[model samples]
Target: MTRRDIEFDAEGVTLRGWFYPAEGATGPAPTIVATHGFSAVKEMYLDVYAEAFAAAGLNAVVYDHRNFGASDGEPRQEIDPVAQVRDYRHAITFASTLAETDPQRIGVWGSSYSGAHVLVVAAIDRRVKAVVSQVPLVSGLANLYALVRADFVGGLRESFDVDREARYAGDSPAMIPVVSEDPLGPAALPTADSWTWFTDTAKLRAPAWRNETTLRSVEMFTEYEPVAHIAAISPTPLLLMPAQHDHLTPTRLAIDAYERAREPKKIVILPGGHFDAYVDGFSVSSTAATDWFVEHLQP
Candidate 1:
């Protein structure tokens, strides 16, 4: 149950978070490289999952994504899926170098947006021997249309265009709330559950958590297609956990993406909305991921 504050280099950015060494481990242990989704920081229940893995005799390297949380990056609060994907690989490299980690026995666990990132990472990174993608975004375009009203789609695109021009003119990137009190209001995640989970979690756990992100972050999200690489994750052992009624990263999308993924994969449907995986269904979600890593990574 020992945890330490740690930092590592991702490209040029310094990402920081807590690392938990496996309890009662004798030597280098199988490790999982993990991070939060979208604009979330490590403090948003990532520690809870890491502790579960560590208690199960697996080393866990949990860190913040660049430009978020304790991580160091410029044009702060920006989220570029491409950059985040590269950072996941860098995290793998960082985990591989740790004395307490078995480089050959590495896994990756990501939830929500990061859940999709792990899918893409497992496809291209041979270093990841096992992967757990929880309530992941399969297709950005699809998820966007699912959450946003059809009539407002055009207006949303126009906002992105306007932000692009402002940024080009050297103005600071326009920002938007990650979640809002009104589900009908403008926000990156405009669901009632997202609003409740994020606001409540921030108040109870991570006060430093911000509710804003660069407007361009939403633009980048519309173009990400992580599920396209789901099939490539085969032979590496994939565990796709989607919530039963997830609306943010709709359950159907995750189920469909799981179908596209090759064998050596298993799907476990959680018993609530998307945010419930980190709250009400945390035990189910964390235990599933911990056992998957132990079975495949052999920690």
Candidate 2:
């Protein structure tokens, strides 16, 4: 499979990544627009899914959210869920303009934090014919509790308030590790799995990825639940893949969201934790996702 550099404008920021066209194709084909989760860059195994899509006779567009990776945004390394969501929307518009992919048959695929993103993207854009959200977060409150130690909970909240003041006053947003050696320390994700995955697995796959995030990023998590939008993604096909042992996003919350979603939806619960699905367990989920897009987007 071959990929080309690509960029799109979203709310005045330029998001950058790669666009993979279907293998040996000279004409437009079904396309899947994709992005990574919180504290992740495009190189962190997102290409695995995009290449799978390309090999499956579908085009794929993989991009970094604004303010992350090779994208252009101020206050770099800050994770903004709201801005990321808008970037996905603008990615749709960008994909439609590409000569390598079908304009009317675009799909959106995201995992972890971005898994929650696709739901909202699909709900608002009728242009998205299908969606694949893997181990999606149901509620920020639940996810926050699952990600950090209880003793550090108060510290996490306090960091946000402090960061906001600093940010507004032209001070650098409080810097926090995206993954820490201590589970109780302040970080976007501090579990043992994430520590190993981000520190080890990501280094192998996404060497360009940084392990830091802004304090404001974690602070914004509380207000960004997309479970409420899941129901609205109907008429358009939805594919929700939640890992069975994903403590980060939690399988139960995804199941709960799945139960509330409308028709024309399918859920495939696979083995492994949230980060596992990005590497060791990627095959199962990506296979299911590729088939879903081929079946829905291609028809």
Candidate 3:
């Protein structure tokens, strides 16, 4: 496997990551554009899948979202769902221009929040030939309610309102921790396990990872609905892999989305939590992913 540094324009900001050429690709090969979930950088685990894809004769392009990792952007450590989705489109366009991969055979893969982004991208972009969504964050409201207690729910909205006003007044966006020891803290993901897994992964593999995002990033979820677009992606092969015991994304949402999905779709329920897909969970998920890409991309 060989990797080279790469960058692409998402609107005007520059986002960067690595591009791995297929090990035995003799010509333009199938390609998959991939990235990480909320508050995560590519080095955390995307390389594990990209390396496998490259070894299997599939070109893999992994990149950091703007304002995170090595990507260049202002208002550092931001997480904008809409802007990130746009980046996926830019990445697909960039991947298609690569002489080493087949643009028409391009696919997309993502986990956690990005897992949901892949769904929306595939629905709107016919250029995406296939998709792999692992432990996808299906609904914004459901995800928010799960993280915050009922009593503080109103308080949460107040905070968002106040922050919105501050931003409108030209004040810098308030920052918040991406995860916290207390589920009630001013954080996005407050589960103890989420905190442990994120911190551990950052220390072990992703020194570039940041543990915070602008407060405004949280509100983007309220308007984003990936499930609404799942059915529109028919004829294009879709693979939904959600852990059986996923605590964060919730298995029920993925299953509901699967029920609504049309033919040319497959779902694998792994026996672990959401982060399991990163640890021992990758074996089944990646194996199925390789087979799916080979069948659909056929390059």
- Could you tell which candidate, 1 or 2, scores higher by lDDT? 1
Model 2 Cα lDDT, one tens digit per residue, 140-185:
8877877676777897677778778787999877888888887766
Residue-by-residue lDDT tens digits, candidate 1, 1-299? 67999888887899898889989889999999999998998989999999999999899999988888889998889999999999999988988888999999999999999999999999999999999999999999999999999999999999999988988999999999999998789999999989999999999999879999999999999999999999999899999999999989999999999999999999999999998899889999998998899998883
TM-score pick, better of 1 and 2: 1
- Where model 2 places Cα greater than 4 Å from the true spot, the runs are 24-26
Winner of 1 and 3 under TM-score: 1
Candidate 1: residue 292 lDDT (0-100):
92
For each candidate in the order shown, give its overall lDDT on alpha carbons. Answer: 0.93, 0.87, 0.88
Best by TM-score: 1
Models ranked on TM-score: 1, 3, 2
Positional deviation of 219 in candidate 3, in angstroms?
1.2
- In order of lDDT, best first, we have 1, 3, 2
Shift in Å, residue 143, candidate 2: 1.4
